[model samples]
Target: MASSLTKGSAATGEKTFLGHPSGLAFLFMTEMWERYSFYGMRALLVLYLAANVADGGLGMNDATAVAIYSVYNAMVYLLALPGGWLGDRVWGARKAVAVAGVVIMAGHFLLAVPSTASFFVGLALIAAGSGVLKANISTMVGQLYRDKNDPRRDGGFTIFYMGINLGAFAAPLTIGWVGQELDWHIGFAMAGAGMALGLLFYFIGFRHLNPVSSRVPDPLSAAEKSAVVRKGLVWLCVAAAAYALIGLAGVFTINYALWPLTVLGLVLPAWSLLRIKRDRDLEPVEQSRMSAYVWFFIAAAIFWAIYDQTGSTLSLFAKGHTESMLFGFGFPESWFQSLNPLFVMALAPLFAWLWVALAHRSKEPSTVAKFSFALVMVGLSFGIMMIAQGAAAGGKVTPMWLVSVYFIQTVGELCLSPVGLSMTTKLAPKKYGSQMMGVFFLAVTAGDSTIALLQLCGVPTDTQSWFASQGALAALAGIAVYLYRKKVKLLMRGIH
Candidate 1:
């Protein structure tokens, strides 16, 4: 690890913001604006796709729109592995992040062009840009902290996370409303402008950033670098050829655009596990820890499958079955998308305090137990929606029900997300650190790819029954993990 603090700087004891480095402020603002662009565009995607052609949308059906949404989101996570690698091996974090901002802005501009071709192209560009940007920015934040064991690390991260929620909370209310009330292209243009502002902020505060942000932690030897470049070019050519062949076969449709991502999502985790299991260099304890991590990955995938409906199935419910009117003024359904992040901003501090209080009492839940709790909470959130479905007045329920669902789900998120990241860092063998983080994200990719596949297969679309089924599965998974928590904890070799 590289520390950029001056000899007498905060790493040596001088206090900055909340006793941390000043660079955190710049990172926080940059991420806040990046997320503003990201969530702003995401909030409008499905709605824009499924709207009537006369209403400035592509006139896609719900299933098709949901399929696209799942694939695109999956790709965002799925590509992070390579994105992180590129940052480590080719471009350092600072330059990679800068290029990502430019690419993302270009994507939004492409969306502003009103055509089906442009829409898909824009989604592709945005997904690729986000893949490059998302993981690197978080890595840079870690680089800002000089001490690995810094007590303030958690608090600083909590503040950074709040910046994420702030952007997410504001995006839907702003860009979402503009897209719904004005023009879809206008909303996309706004997202582009948000990225521009983020880039501007980053450049203005560039001087505060540490030299660590521009360091390549793991540089390749000349021979290895040459081989890697050659392999990359080969794979690029192969992928292009495969796509061309698929299109020529007349089977390439928008609905199947996710197939490539889906295949990779399914295959990558299995490959990672196989590599881990076969690594003779790993000690027995390390192997056991990796085995336990596999279970956590499964549990996370299940949780995400149910939790991610907020962008797909739940969004559809908000459009068709949730009352959007408040005090006689109707609002865009996308405004409801803000509820999750809004609740996060409100509730995260309380959850943080709760965890600390529990820790002080020697009653903090085991990592596996926390994962189980998250699963159950998310399951129960869906159960609430199922019950709300039963109480619908004339087939439409008040938006408070959705609000309640998001609130509970946010609690689940706070429990799982931070813990998952911490666990990955703590349990991964040093040699496999980056690959282990990639595996963690693969869980998200698996969940999203599964959802996309389900949509493509024309799964039964009854909202109530669907929610009920997902809740039941999630609850059962939680119970199973809870039952085996003690066994799993042993495999963790003292890690919490």
Candidate 2:
């Protein structure tokens, strides 16, 4: 919408790749390596933390390790709120992305150093950089289109999402092997190198873009900047005080440390929704659409509660409850982390075509309907996991069980994730673009909160019931979404 090239004519014309803009190709490559860096390090995080110091790990307990991993993962998403603000208001999205890349690359390099201090510092930097990069890069992908109704939109997003899996599919195999089988720092260093290459490709192909992201969506005035700085310091102090209180009370464990962040995971999305709905600039239709989005948002939260796309939990499951042996060779548990992304790489193009083909026949499911179906897929995936867990009580089950589960979730992911990305861009207010993208990611954070709460309270002794209860809840939520799909569509005010 900020295009300098005649309403994004350049975006749809001249250079093209796979029937879309060539800029999509550049973004695709960039995202591939960024995700490569992310998932690569993510695959090894909990394992490294839980490993013995004799093996060059911190040797933390299972609960602490898992809690830290979940909170770290959730924070990476929660920070997207501020990241989006900076992208839209402080700097242009393009500039924000480039700077965030440097931060992310630096973070990975730091992790390569293999020290306790270095590890924490590295995680902080990567989380902040990732939060910034994730929101803006996705926003940039949306900018490559002409308008909300562009038929190329979903397909283009699927391609970009495929880029994510391309990296995810490969990183764990390479980085996970090095981290788990060799040296952890070397694997982290490899992640850094991946990010650096992403930066190189991004800068080399910068001119391919339409420069639509160059214009700030909303620039803060001098008065607003001063106000923001003042407010920021006050909140910073409040945070420090609360953190100190946790230490003073002598409950400064990882479980307690996560309280603020997990609570933020819940509070921020709700606050963002209420604030958006209250915006005076919104037309009646915009208000209606925002209201409609609340259902999608909540449903997505429920879906992610069962999804946990990080694979950390499942990697642990694979380590203990599932076998990684094939013939005479054994593989690391992290190898299972690659399954979801590999399936995405194989399935995305098909799903992309399916949506367009359905659209041509006027038989395409509404976005809400697709979301309903996704919930059911995840519910069913968990049902299988429940059975697998029950089977594990007898002995380690076949790896195919986990494989089947990832395949089902991948189907759910193909239905919801990329479509959700495209849908957010469609529904965003003209002025609040990047921030709205950030709000969409909070679904992941909200899901993290739910899981973290369950984990911290205590592990459930009955693993089957644990899985069954969650699976049934997801099935019920799916039915509820299906029942309300018609009303949700009406509230969309013609978005479909």
Candidate 3:
């Protein structure tokens, strides 16, 4: 990996790190460990919730557990809005990400304390922290590559993504297993350790982070300075109001209060962009693509809602109805969570090659085709679930069934997600590139939260009926993608 970094750097005249900056490696490692902690926590969450109180778990009912899971997952991506705002208009990306990492570290430490109060507090802090790190880190990655048309851009993201999966692939099998088989706090402590490693790397390589966008003030022209102050005050007021309301409406569910704010959060940006288009100098294509990017965010959110359920409903599915033994080798349930990232690591290179190969032949499918494929694969994963249900109707369901489902989902992810990253970079106006990426991730927020909500509504773990209902939604999403495939394709006409 270091060799690849050096080789890319050499190729790029040694100005950038492995064609980005040496600093990129620091960010990569930081993100890798952060994901390790996050995915590790995720792998154990459902099992931890469903575990009996006698087994040192909370013994929460599936519905309530799933709801919390959904909200937490949703907030992970949703917090990016304010995170990016802080990075762009307040502190800058690097500082925001660093601070966010610290916050996440604190969250993990809270989980290690082993109290119900600490658990909720820890989750809230981690969610807020992810909002900061998740968006800004990617922005820094883009900053490392000064050349917009650099051939290494896609490869760089691929490399960065691999780092993510490295942590993801290991976390579940290790931290999750230890947590489940022994103590839950041990897993959380492991997560906290991972964050510490990430923070260490960030500080160690801080000097290499030149050209990084900071949240600190730049030497601005008169208009730019005024704009910054105005936006800052607006965000400050909004945040204060939102916090005040949260405190006042203590009886209301956090999700209920937050969802409305989510809407408000979205509209605020839309209003900003509308004014930009109406009054500020803008390119037509840039404006159009930005609009399309918003729609894509909605679509992406839907996908995540279905996909991220692995941590909530699907984890339970493996534990409950699915027969997880093979030749008397009963697989660890947390091990199942490892499959997605493992497949991603295994197949990403092949897909990257395939995409390039297709492009060379002038036969590459449009971005919409890739997205349609993603929806189809998502439906197919659930279809496998449906089949597993049928196979297990009278007896144990084979572990192969769930494995097949994860494999299929991974393929869908390969087609849709990495490609979506490229698409986001292509579509957003230059000024809003990082913010748009943040917006693209909002789909994850909606998707993960939606999954959690489904679980809470008694559709995921407690009842086989609820689990089966997911198949119907997956099917509908596939149909919707198919029906609108052409229209979506039209939006991508000039993106590539």
lDDT of 2 by residue, 1-496 (tens): 2223223444435567776776888889999999999999999998888789999989887666676777787888998888888988998889889999999999999999978878888998999999989879988888888677889897788789779888999999999999999999999999999999999989987887768787788899999999999999999999889879988998776655677777877888889889998999998888888888889898888888778833656666787788888676789988888988888778877887999899999999989888988988898888888898899989899998889999999899889987897799888877666567788898888887777777777765237786778778887888898898889888888887
RMSD of 2: 4.3
lDDT of 3 by residue, 280-299 (tens): 45577666666666555665
Could you say which candidate leads in lDDT? 1
Arrange candidates by TM-score, highest first: which order? 1, 2, 3
TM-score of 3: 0.84
* Residue-wise C-alpha lDDT for candidate 1, range 52-110, written one tens digit per residue: 99999999888878878888888898888888987898788988899888999999989
CA deviation > 4 Å runs, candidate 3: 1-20, 146-151, 211-295, 429-431, 455-469, 491-493
Q: What is the lDDT of residue 284 in candidate 2?
A: 84
Q: Which stretches of candidate 1 lie over 4 Å from their true place?
A: 1-19, 249-251, 390-393
Which is the winner by lDDT between candidate 2 and candidate 3? 2
Over all chains combined, what TM-score does candidate 1 have?
A: 0.94
